[model samples]
Target: MTPRFAITDAEIATVVAEFYAVARTHPGLGPVFAAHVTDWPAHEAKITRFWKNAIQFDRSYDGNPLQVHRDATDVRAGMFDVWLGLFDSVLRRQLPPETAAAWSTLAHRIGRGLRFGLTPQNGGPPDLRGPAR
Candidate 1:
C-alpha cells in the first residue's frame, strides 16, 4: 500500500485508543496488560507518543521498548501476535486502507522484535542445537 504522507498525533491517539481497547480485553493479552499497566490513560498517551515517534520521526518518545517488554515477566511469545492481530483489526476498522496497512506492517515488525526479545533463549531444542550431548 502507498504511504499517505505522515500519520498525525490525532490519528496516533485514535489508533492507540481503539487498539488498546481491544488489547485490554484480548484473551491472550488482557491479563498481561492488566498485570503491567495500571493507568490506562497514561499508558494510552505513552503508546501514542511511541507511535508518533515511529510514524512521524517526531522523537517525542524516550522509553526503552525492549527493556519494558523484557521487564514484563508476563509477556509471552504468542502474545505479540495477539497484540499485532488486535492492532491490525482495529486499525483496519478505524483508519484508511493504506494507513491501516502501513501501521499494521509497522506493528507486526515491532511485534516480531518484541516477541524475539521477550521469549527466553534456553539454547535451542535438541534438534535445533548442536549434536546431542
Candidate 2:
C-alpha cells in the first residue's frame, strides 16, 4: 500500500534509527530505555516495523503497544510528551514538512491514547508498569 505521505520505507527507517540514537542519550528517556533495551538493533527494527505499519499500512508489525508500554514500569505519564517531542524533531529533520506533520499528528494521537492508559483516571494505576490495562 502507498504511504499516506510520500515517505519511503528507507526514510522511515532512517528517522527511526536517528530518533532512537538520540533518545538513547536523552536525559529523560535514556535510563528508562536502557533498563529494557539491551539490543539496540533489534529494538529499532521492531519500532521500524511499527512505524511502517502505522504510516504505510505495511502490516509488518503485530504487537500490542499499549500492553508493552504498560509492562515497562519505568514509563511515566510525562514521558510521552518527551518521546513525542523527540520523535517530532527527528521526523522534521529526516522527512519533508508535509510528511513530518502527518506522521507527527498520528504519533501524538497514539501517544495520547497510550498516556491515557497509563494515567490514574483510566481506572488504573498512575504508572505504566502497575496494574494498568
Candidate 3:
C-alpha cells in the first residue's frame, strides 16, 4: 500500500529538482554526483520516478538503489548525512509541513539503509550481495 503522506507527484518532482539543483553545486555532493550523472534532466526524471515509486508505490522506477550506490565507489558514509540534509531542506521548502515531515521520515529511513549497505562491515569492503539482477 502507498504511504499516507498526502504528497503529490508534482511536489515530489519539485523537491527532487530543487534538491539536485542545489546539491549538484554543493562542494561535497557536487563532484560525486557529477561524476556519475552526465544528463541532469534525465537523472532528475529517473530520481523523480524513484521517489514516486517510493512514496506512492507507482511502480514507475525499476533500479536497485543499493546496487547503484555500491557501484559509486566515491560515495562515502558521511555523504548520506549531507544528502539527507539537502533533501530535507528541499522537502520543507516545496511541500506542506505534514507532507514534508512524512517524506523526510521515509527519506531518512532509506538513507540509513543505503548508508549501511555502503559502509564497510568488520573493516572489510561493503558487501555487494550479488547485484540487482
Using lDDT, give the best candidate's number. 2
lDDT of 2: 0.86
Q: Which sections of candidate 3 miss by over 4 Å?
A: 122-133
For residues 1-133, write the lDDT of model 1, one tens digit per residue: 3222467778889989998888877777788889999999999989888888766767789898878887887777777766777788888888899888878877776777677776678332222111233
lDDT ranking of the models: 2, 3, 1
| Per-residue accuracy of model 3 over 21-75 as CA lDDT, tens digit each | 9998999999999999999999999999998988877889999998898889989
List residue ranges in candidate 2 displaced over 4 A.
123-133
| Pairs with backbone N, CA or C atoms under 3 Å apart (clashes), candidate 3 | none
Model 2 Cα lDDT, one tens digit per residue, 2-114: 56667888998999999999999999899999998999999999999998988788999999888888899889878999999999999899888998998988888788778
Query: Candidate 1: global Cα-lDDT?
Result: 0.76
Worst lDDT run of 10 residues, candidate 2, spans 124-133
Evaluate model 3: give its lDDT.
Answer: 0.84
Q: What value does the lDDT take at residue 10 in candidate 2?
A: 96
Give the higher-lDDT candidate: 1 or 3. 3
